[model samples]
Target: MSEFADRIRPHAPTRDDASARRWIYVPYDRLTDATGPLTEQPASQTGIVMMEALAKAHRRPYHKKKLALILASQRHFALKQARRGIKIIYEFTPGIFADGLEQATRHHRLSALTMMQPAEREMSLDVEEARVRGIPLQLVEDTTWCSTESDFDSVFAPTTKHFLMDRFYRRMRQKTGILMQPNGEPIGGKYSYDAENRRPYRGQPPVPERPRFHPDSITQEALHLVAREFPSHFGTLDGFDLPVTQAQADEAWSFALEHLLPHFGPFEDAMAHNEPDLFHSRLSALINISRLLPRRLIDDVARAAHSERIPLASAEGFIRQILGWREFMRHLHRRTDGYRQLPGQRNNSSSDDPYAGAEPSALNAHRPLPAAFWGRRSGLHCLDTVIDQVWREGWSHHITRLMVLSNLSTLLGVSPRALTDWFWIAYIDAYDWVVEPNVLGMSTFADNGLTATKPYVSGAAYIHRMSDYCGHCRYNPRKATGDASCPFTSLYWSFLDRNADNLSSNPRMSMPYVTLRKKPASELNELRKRAAQAIEELCHAQQASPQE
Candidate 1:
């Protein structure tokens, strides 16, 4: 695996906490959005940062790069606390998540602690951990985002089962009154304006340039340290944007609100060939870790949209992203068997060991996580191209994750274990909670249609329609008949053709499949052949290269 993580392991205290007195407990942060000025700093240092530095020095540059980014970013946050005179400790756990209070209390020997995280499940885990560990825990409000837990939950009671985002979102519109009519109804008598949200950028060469914050001295030192430590991972330190302080994070948030939030709605779902960050908020990693708050970001954008300063469609779109998808995902992970092995997926049922599986589990088919996909015989480049792309860019718009990369992995019949493992390795924003749902549930269809209704599959034409990638692409979207035809084109048609026996009858897909089935059989046969060839070429190229 990754040398950055492998070389650095968590240090267990040799002596028990029976003698300790003075301490400040700081939880691990995957997304520093939780650690605003309000939360107490974690009182220890987990040496993942130094390990990342060493790995960068000794390992292959790709492996080093990705690991370095995570460690550097985390290290930057840790340094921020030190300058404030907080007695911070960074514990180097195998995982970056300090997820529950029990883990924090037990691991750090804490008598009392304060956290400013907004995710309820994580808070619930902390509470239970505190109860079991006999430590006092306070759920301090996080100021990084615009909204608060109380504000969001004010729309809820402890035992309500019928709550959905639409109602909650309406409350948001009313509370913020962003797009309200002068008479007090939402402007246009409706709060959600999603209809105008998905237009393809149908214009000329006028894409806005992303503002680059060239690595500052602090970021540069962290980058050099990471590169020197973890040399075998992925990514480049060239565009590292780790906001060490809340003020910096706020500044980054302001840039997004003032410049990107308006057009965020229409082009949010749109993805082109290589433009992964297109109008999308690159704030997830920051938000996830407590560097910024989603509520305030939501409020600011919502107020702007409501006041007609930003378009209603844009504001509504942004709100949906924060309220609808992000929060729903958090609750879903906690409430359901999301972290547990369900039905027939695994054996161990205890929630503590998330991967311990369900009931009398099946063979750990998912465990040894077949590296053959990485061995180059798998033909899809799931490990190489996809990993490379994700490492270089901390975030890839959802469509790229779902359509091109994830779709190829599914169609290539690569195991979900391998696909998700790659996601775990690559994304800067990945954590067990968020990454698992998108990877296993949405991309790999490992959840068996829980997170998404069906697998997202596409060939070239669709990818071409959404962005400018096709214009510079080596393959042709229109050519289903020859080598010039994108492998995606034929593969897409062929996948639908092959899966038609199962997918065609499904109500949601009948419309598309019916149209596809009418195409000439000869055309489809040719398309399948091209896809296979393309797959073979990709496999050969990746494997022959020294990187894999």
Candidate 2:
């Protein structure tokens, strides 16, 4: 055992009389005091139960950096609590989360436990099961989000098939008053600055370096632990630079305000060949893991914009992500019963695999997710670069995620469940609350417009216009049939042609369908042949991959 683990493992307080103490269970993500159960009870009267489930960590090929970040952050949080005189029952145990909870409860004599509602569906179910077994658990509201379930229910009916982000965002703006005027209208007379935020970067103003936090002794221990435990997981363990404490997270936020936010809007959608994090705030992992609270970050960003420290587009763009999309994902996850209520769940499937027997996507996509996603080079510069970035960092900007990864997956007819599983396994910021709604509902249109108005699929032309990867790619963006043709271009037309019946009626997709119809049948035949060749190559690559 490591010296740190040896020193810290036996710190659980011993008490002859344990029934008087009430305990709080802290999940891996919910590590902040802003919404933590500690606010509901005192440290003297309340103990803390912290668990690290080895089996759960190994359930999927999670990013190695993600595992290290979570482990380090949880350890830091527990250490902070221990210093505050809180009795901590920290378990680095085997099996699932519930198993660890059971061991802690049994050994520590915890009769009644209090905890915040977890951000993921499986943990929530585990908590429910514990309650069903008469554990006397007091479940508190998850206060991490700016809006509550009631807020979502107020604007959207229970039977509402589609959840509009703009409407929900407006409600949150009015509720939080982040970018609102005194008259209750949105500041600058607009709720969205999305149109103004889509400029391609020509490298006029050079991108600044993001602040990196070198691992401390505690973080080093966590890194070693993850390396020892999850050696086979995806992503590199080297270059672990994320913030593990609130102070460090605040420092990163301050750095973003000064250096990154100025160009974050204009370059928000822009992707460069080697620049993986161009002007985008690397705060999603910190925010999702609760090192930084959303409300404070949103308020600070608004204040910065209002004071002319940053442009309105940048502030509104950043705020829209946190105040708009982030909260929408959470609420929609809960509303949709956190993937349990998603169509096509099998009766025999385990809770660990929510989408195991999921039906074919709306477009009837059934091909396996290609091995290219697991770090194999597809010979396409855009796909290869983004995959390599994810392999190294466990992250990529949203544009790369939506337009490149998900777009290609959609066009290539990769199975929605397979793609969703890849996303959940690969991303550092992914959780059921965030990853499921984004993958199934928005990115791939697997939920068939339940959370999105239209599919986010795009052709090579869009990729070429938005990124420099096309310039370096061997494939031609203009061609759609020959061996030199871009897969995105060829498959995009094939996708539209293949799913015209299902998508042609969508108001947003009418023009695309018209364009698809304008193409000659001879050229459409060639495009399908090219798409078939690409899928065949992907099948060969996946078959050769050991991980697949």
Candidate 3:
């Protein structure tokens, strides 16, 4: 037997029974769904398997807080199950998930292992591997998500066209009866309050103090373990304060509703210096871990809004994130065969341009991701501050993510897969399913405009307007060349000039193309030169930095 298999021994319900009939393998993310197996079998007959797969953690250098959060949350959940008289088998192993499962099956003498379908593609494959190895594993439906595979099939079966999120979102709203009127119309006579949600924060009404949970013994132990095991990880463990238990997660959610939700909508796109989390709910880790259910949270928000406490815009905005974007992304993942059927390109070739028809087998972006992305100072205040926050806290609001980091990477022509991997490793909330679609499709437009209608590229002006980062930075948002020029300003025009052949035909890009056409040839060439220089300087800086 392997050393990993040796470490996969059972920890609780230390009975010497060699004939335990049923067992449930509860992956860390499916802590709440374990209720299904817990209710079906007696506590004595039911054994729960939770593993700390060290091999998985080292796949990418993850944020320390992210590592601590998952480990602590899993340990706490296992302890709770053990307290409820369920047999718990918590394993720590540096091996493939299949090895752990095989060892677990033997240690418990499990006749059958029940598990809810995994949310991630990789984990689902691991379960398949276990089945091929002859473990009697039974996969059940994942009830945590409001939508299911059948629901996705029903929505997509009618058409061979690309899945649009708005239509799917409306279908979900109607199906769930959430944020809808009695007559089946949307509340406030609109399906989206997005137009009302983009006001910049002028620092007038004071932002609420973020709620923090002191690390208890359980969390402290998990923190120490992570520090020792993954000392070279990206983030620091100085202020690790994420909630680990169900009660703590509930408390954090309550704090958001009371103090932040009312202002969450208007400032949802706003960013500020020293304010890493402005009005955003930091409940993603909790929600992903199953400590909080999305449906329940949505229902609670709607209920509070109905009482005239939460504004319609705030409630609508928040609900749109969950009911609309979150569900839409998951269903889109299910309906599409990975990147094989991405938007404009069919059979890896575009129908419009015969010359530009061939899609690269790899991501189109060939530029190396800057070392500044891993917390090195890039001198650009917005990027530097956001990276710093991620290294320290493993969190940053969506605006910083989309408008700043993603926009910069897209502008610089950074590889979509490289950027996606960085996001998965850096953020506490990131997973492959979540990060891949958001990064490749929405952020980079590397999926050829499948997820986003247009590439989310912006000149520094947009960043300056939306955030206070420009106020303190040395670069000029308006200047497109010279020493004080913002790289974003030069790159924006260069991006338009470079991709004009592909984008000129796009109706949505007509205005930018017209502007591009009006610009003098000399000016456009200067902009391109400046963009090349900026990219070269960034690459050089990264190359000079000591490797992490």
Candidate 4:
């Protein structure tokens, strides 16, 4: 027997017992029939273990809506399974997940506790520890993903130094035959429609109203539970409309197809003052929780485009997010172990200058995350508006996340670790698997060129063009200095100036470097001073935060 096999002793069979009692442990996120031991094991013989692990939920200051959605989903799934005559051992334990699992396993005297492989690395390690501690824990394959590990390996191997997302996306397209012609060409004669998808929304095509799901009894109970337990947690559950069951998720998906799909591609990158869900599918929370599978959604989108019900750009754009970015991020996070070991190893230049060849995490960005992130008021209209939306809904589209939250954080030199944790805690769709690769690699360039070729840092001009935030703001987007200068504008120039030596070598950054080289020393010094003041003001706001 292997060392792992030997450590996890199987439950001894009794003379009177024909077979050992086996249980399938279901986590909060894995609430579907798509993957895990639930698929392989016979329902008649297998018992189910569902836990409401309060200790685990309280580890971070998670948003209340996120907490309610997860707990409510788990409870509803358990009830559905029980109604089908499956034996469910539901444990509402106040301990951590591992503690609850071990206690339940021992109390039941099960032969083995089978589970789907956890999405987060910490939970995976916890499972390994349980096995080593003599618990008969077995992990089955996680089949919720549309692409397999083999598909990822075909594009980029373990030893491959450079990896492109487009190449990986193409491999998945060929493997799945999605949006591909009979002759194996892309349907639109192009692999990506990202270039054509950047048009800003200008109030022409009226944004449709999304359907709201009234809270069912189970969901109401879950919300009450969250309210009583985590009252101090960030975000309110007053307007929580997230789907808690497969049926509700299906309804939401259908609504997205009818209303959001046609205009999703064109205005995907745009941000408006009060429109938080402008043409966004808003299916990420449901999809991430496995209430809806990625494969089915992609198939539906391809069919819609083929029938000309929705434009090819809209279908392809949405499909790429699932087949291209979502799958890519999952595999990358799995390979890198949440990017804990990726930093400082990629750029190890022996230089006195800190950012001479530093990776994203090593860019010496030691500033703290500001109080505005937690719904505290900031003087800037863009930050305040986006943060308020996120606080209310537990969501924002990708562009708002990348350009507004992560962009400004990067320019202000906030710690990557802080930003990563905040993303995981604040957003309903964010998990360790998705949030780390995005915040560390793509958003912050912490992985240096692992996921993104160039740092996504931008001046206020990009925001001004992409959003209507500047028009309503008190500060001037064009100014890089003085009291009324836009913080994004000032910090952007300061960020470029601070890291000129490190980024100037890259061909993609040549344009910005050329502009930086032309700027006189006096103007550069003044910009740096303005950036320092902005950082100081943010720190003051953080110290004065209500939550603090």
Best by lDDT: 2
- The numbered model that scores best in TM-score is 2
Q: Which digits, one per residue and each the tens of the lDDT, describe model 2 over residues 119-197?
A: 8887877777676666767888888878888999999987787788999999999988888998999999999999998
Error of 4 at 116 (Å): 1.7
Cα lDDT tens digits for candidate 4, 1-548: 32212221232223222134457888887888656567665665556777888887887778889999998888788777765545666676898677777787777676677888787665776677678778888887788888778888888877875567899999999888999999999998999999989987778698888888888877888898899998888777988888888788889999999889989998889998867678889889888888988999999989999999889999999999999999999988777656754533643333554212222474777678888887667788888998888788788999999999999999988988778888877888988889888888889976767788888989889999998899999999988799998989889888888887778888999998899889999988888899999988885553523145
Mind sharing the TM-score for model 2?
A: 0.95
| Candidate achieving higher TM-score, 1 or 2 | 2
Please report, as a residue range, the 10-residue window in candidate 1 with the lowest summed lDDT: 46-55
Q: List the residue pairs that clash in candidate 3.
A: none
Poorest 10 consecutive residues of model 4 by lDDT?
3-12
RMSD of each: 7.6, 2.3, 4.7, 6.4
Q: Model 4 compared with the native: what TM-score?
A: 0.92
Candidate 1 all-Cα RMSD: 7.6
* TM-score, predicted candidate 3 vs. hidden true structure: 0.92
Q: List ranges where model 4 is wrong by over 4 Å.
A: 1-22, 34-36, 343-360, 540-548
Error of 4 at 454 (Å): 0.7
For TM-score, candidate 1 versus 4, the one ahead is 4
Residue 476, candidate 2: how far off, in angstroms? 1.2
The sequence of per-residue lDDT tens digits that candidate 3 reaches over residues 332-443 is: 6555543445544555434453212223222257577888886667889889999888888888888899989889888887877667778888899887567767776778
* lDDT tens digits by residue: candidate 1, 1-548: 33322222223222333124234333435345244432432334211111122321232233333454455566565555445433344444333233333455566556555554435343345346455556665555544444445655676655543335566667766766655676779776777777777666654234566655565555565577666654445455556655545666787788888777777888876765445566776777767665566777777886786567777778878877776667655544544445354333452245464332222111112322323333344322322444445655655767677876777666555556555646655566665557655666666655555555566776666667766666655566777769666666676676677666656766877777877878887776777787677555653343322244
Whose TM-score is higher: candidate 2's or candidate 4's? 2
CA-lDDT, candidates in order: 0.55, 0.83, 0.78, 0.80
